[model samples]
Target: KESLDVIKVLTSKVRWITLLQRLTLKQLWVARNVSRVSIAIWKEKSQAVHQYCARWIYNSSIAFNAIDNDDFRLFCEALGQFGPGWQPPSQYQLREPLLNEEKKRTKEKLKHLEEEWETDGCSVMTDACTDMKRRSIMNLCVNSRGGTCFLGSKDSSKDSHTGEYIFEYIDKCIEEAGPLKVVQVVTDNATNNVAAAKLLKMKRPNIFWSGCAAHTVDLMLEGISKLPGIAKLIDQAKCLTIFIYAHHKTLDLMRSHTQKRDIVRPGATRFATCFLTLHSLYEKKALLKNMFGSDDWHECVHSKSVKGKASYETVMNIGFWSSMTLVLKIFSPLVKVLRLADGEKIPSLGFIYGEILVAKNSIKEATYQMERNYEPIIKIIDEKMKGRLDAP
Candidate 1:
């Protein structure tokens, strides 16, 4: 009625009817646009929720790669099982009740290992390393039927790394690990560590001390590197690498020729790195030949230098190649042993003795059963092997 009264002021009622039709169409268009806008907003908000969760993960110092873990996916799926309208636990709940409950569950998982500990026993492992602050820190752990479990670390920055100082820490760790449950202690074969192990053995007649097999093998590799032939090879290889890598253009040229494969193969230890680098060099023999002979190398200023000429000659030298082959044959078997001793795949303790024998046989075969060529190498291996197999 009010609309009609208002329309009475208009000369034609058709005009008001036409105006109402336009208004209805405009309202419908606005409603449709609003619906579309709401959908876009929902999608943007959905993506933002994921970003928000990721931001929390980053802020909390969680590993970004953990998002790829099956556990993480399962965790999300488990949460979804709680269904909609269920909120996550609050920060206080996570800190108090949930944390306490998680601690209980974790402890429960270790209960099964108690029987293994009482029966087969365990070995306490003390590993000393330098921190980012350059402080000397030793971490204590125990390995048994349950695998390795970390005890803790001690900062020995001030104390001298003598037998007595080390023994005290080992004694404390042994007591903490339940002395009767620990059968052996393992550490690097440093002179001080050896002295410490001796002291530990004297103090605890029931417990034996052993050297790290990996460290012993690494020392063997070190001895090999110091050999006259090996020393010369390493020095020449280092010189060649320095000449190539020290310069931008030559390094780029070398990479291009070798399809970007680096000649420097770094390993866990310096001596192992030497052998690995030798292996890399032997693999790229043809590539190195082509690189040095290329017009690109000839055009480079480094090619005219004394270092460049020496590098080229070394690559070209048949004698160098021969020595490298002989050294690799000896070192290749040892490298495999080192890897096995250092690795955790399938309990290497039982397989180590057999593997060492196999490696020695492999070395003999590598030398074509020539005793004269392999005697010196075998002597070095025997000296290192004694410390590993003969120890606890």
Candidate 2:
């Protein structure tokens, strides 16, 4: 009874009963009553059999390139060496056959996904990224009750990637995912993507098309950055940064003056960095002006340089300072709402509509209720939002 109990526990750990039925008679003989002295010869064969299933799973769930790393295999081997039940999967097992197995499993999952979609609708999202080879790949994913699942990916390098081309892919994904069960399609606010969304909407009038909010706000910022005054300010700010960082002496001096905080903070995007740099420069106005006016600044050769003169003049220009202040005032409200949409902790859908209204009103207030100044910026924002499907 004690021996039987021990065998049951061990066999259950390895799924021995199922494995035995699947094995040939000789393999079954080895699986059941292998001699301990001959076990070393069978270890590799036994390991391969057990690890074949594991290899398929790893290739499907994780990255395909993971099997290429010798370190990963070494780590798995070390675990198998220390642990008793299983062995490390060979890299060969992670190749062609494993990929085919993964495809089989994917078909099963898609069937499950379709079933879920029948009960609860799903949303599809498409995003394009350039892989290591610099080939453009469009990834299609579906979000259902089971969470987001990768449906497929298409390489667009050979394709036109126009609005019509994008729509074809979107339409195919929608069809594969069950068009009747799809609630919406989400994509970035790129020109082609927006056009694709519009075409998709026309085709399936009931399904909503959601343009990415973050991308829309970024477009708004991009439009603002193109304004003549804003463009000039950004150029001056970049020149100031280049001047300060070019010479070590001025860099140290500026750091000391500003208490080691850089006036130009890096941002994820070019326009974002431009605005953030402008904001930082505006905040440290006094310190920078004082630095330029200091006795040490007079002695420094950099202050006498051509670049230095331009930076100093820009910093001292009252017009430039006023423009910076105005830009900040107009965009700060929008930035706040953009942050809310970008955040992950809380869902922004609940407050985003209200927030946009407040933001537009705040911009009017910032311009001191002046129609001329505020109206243009408001109009730009409105046009951008409408184009991106962000407008109510």
Best by lDDT: 1
Tens-digit lDDT track of model 2 for 1-392: 99999998997978876776667777867766667646876897789855995688676897767667898789768877787776545788778777789889978987888789889999999999999999999999998777788888988898888998999899999898788899988889889998898898789988888887767777888887777776787788789989999999999999999999998887755666777888899999999999998999889998888998998898888998998898888778877777777777424443766787788999899889999877777887898878454532
Shift in Å, residue 365, candidate 2: 0.7
Worst 10 residues of 1 by lDDT: 344-353
Q: Tell me the whole-model lDDT of each prediction, alpha carbons only.
A: 0.86, 0.83
Clashing pairs in 2: none
**What TM-score does each of the candidates earn?**
0.79, 0.70
lDDT of 2: 0.83
